[model samples]
Target: MNAIIDKLKMLKYVEVTASWLFANAKGRDAKTFVKSPQFASYPEPTIQITSPDCGASPATLSPEYMAGGDGRLPGLEWESVPGVKQWLLICEDVDAPLPNPICHGLYLGISKDKLSVTNSDFKPENEKSTRLNGGFYYGTNRLWIPPRPLLNHGIHRYFFDIIALSEPLDEKLAASKPTREQLAKEIDGKILGWGRWIGQCERVWK
Candidate 1:
């Protein structure tokens, strides 16, 4: 009976491996996504985002910023360009196991007077304070949506994007939750500057 149990365990391992391979066979790997031309066509503004907490373009991510980690959003500082009235902040995982990349965070209605976000700004209990700062609305990414990419999927890249808009979003627009598609409608001709930072996270699932 013990020998039979061991054989079953081995078979289970093989099945898991096969499932992972099938899920990732389409070359949805991070390397290809980072280099994909679709990225090039997107608007890139001259603004910049940084963290007193992190170095510029560090390849590896700390567990504190990843899914299943402590989930403390690293504090961020950014610059604004001339003619900007507001900004949008977003974080996206380009290598999820799905038809499209997952949108982790989509924060809108950030005011021009604001230039930074702290770890506490992400706490759900602090809505009053968040709305008072860079926010007329703190859309999606209200929570720090960490990367939990499957190990077999290889390393995943999460992009933190900031876009400067020429004017404050309309009150009606601020009240509604906007998806990436909806946000694009307002941004198409109005963006003045863009800032971005990328981090890589990989899990050890097997």
Candidate 2:
């Protein structure tokens, strides 16, 4: 067992799979697994999420706007607000069919100077190096997976949760994109304020 763990530790991608298997084996409800309750537990909304990419809650997102399509991150703008040292952005599909919500993208430790993120910022090539010097860290969608919701899974609610932190993250925490649990744990009572936007998506064709 120790040997297996050691090997898994060296392979982050496989580690994600193994953990997912264990979490879903019992058939836990989607909400129970998809979200980290700790992260969900917050004071209240402080910053405002801007829909620089599209209109407020479109009726249905077309294919080209999704993973199966161009796979580009939509443009988004939000305020740095006050009383915060860094920011975090996460795009999640809470309505995913699986036990856990699918993470389309995650970025952390954004400098307060940013103010907004554009589609170009989501480019795959920017991956690790993007954060190496920008005082930020980007966590690629889990396993480089895109936000391709399976058709007939029902309309998915994608949330862009933007948070402001009271203090700068430690070197380790800011080094990479944090997992849901990690985000919850790290932000435990440390969040200053937050805001979010919801987008609806559904696959219409087979």
Candidate 3:
């Protein structure tokens, strides 16, 4: 499925022209979406998230992480915040040509004791890694879906937002395998703190 999408994306002329035709269409931004839950502003003493593979915030993600390449999830690390018992991590494309921000990955049950996850750790469900073996479960999207923006669709921003929770999510809720929207609503004021790292990507063939 992804291979087909990648192939279509390579049709640079078709993609660029189609994208230009729908230039007025809009996509949701993560910044604005976060405001709905009033999680808009980070609370005092926020954690700083960074990706060694993707470099610093607002950095450009390599093709290997996109559908055109290996589609591996970027490795990420962050400072541990006190009193966080569990964590929720969401990777989203704020510039996707959709009404809502597209969720690339949603994970729950991240133990606070774990500070980082390497790219190799995220693999096919059949081939599990230690990080995933730590009782973590994927959300609606299930696993990482590599970003594959259309050619000339302009640059797309991926926001890796991790929320520190004072307690673990409800067992029933976790079992439901909720979507990003559902998970965000469930977390609400339960947030202890949060951090975000941004990586940008674009499909351009010239």
* Candidate with maximal TM-score: 3
Per-residue C-alpha lDDT of model 3 across residues 1-206, encoded as one tens digit per residue: 99988886667667788789766554576343354564755633277989888887988988888897988788899988888989888888877766677878888878778888877555534544313544677778467889898677888888888788888888667756687678778877778788888888888776
lDDT of 1 by residue, 1-206 (tens): 99999997786676557548756643333432222333344434366787777657544678887777876666778886898888778877766766566777777788787888876665544544335333455554244576776655567777777777887787667656666666776666667767777777776544
The better candidate by lDDT, 1 or 2, is: 1
Ranking by lDDT: 3, 1, 2
- Stretches of candidate 1 off by over 4 Å are 1-19, 22-42, 125-136, 140-142
For candidate 1, which ten residues in a row score worst on lDDT? 26-35
Error of 1 at 82 (Å): 0.5
Write the number of the candidate with greater TM-score, choosing between 1 and 3: 3
- Which candidate, 1 or 2, would have the higher TM-score against the true structure? 1
Question: What value of lDDT does candidate 3 attain over all alpha carbons?
Answer: 0.75
Error of 1 at 70 (Å): 1.1
* Local distance difference test values of all predictions, in order: 0.66, 0.63, 0.75
TM-score of each: 0.74, 0.71, 0.82
By TM-score, the better pick of 2 and 3 is 3
Q: lDDT tens string, model 2, 101-174?
A: 66777778777778777766654444445353334666642523455644434466777778887777775665
User: Against the hidden true structure, what lDDT does model 1 obtain?
Assistant: 0.66
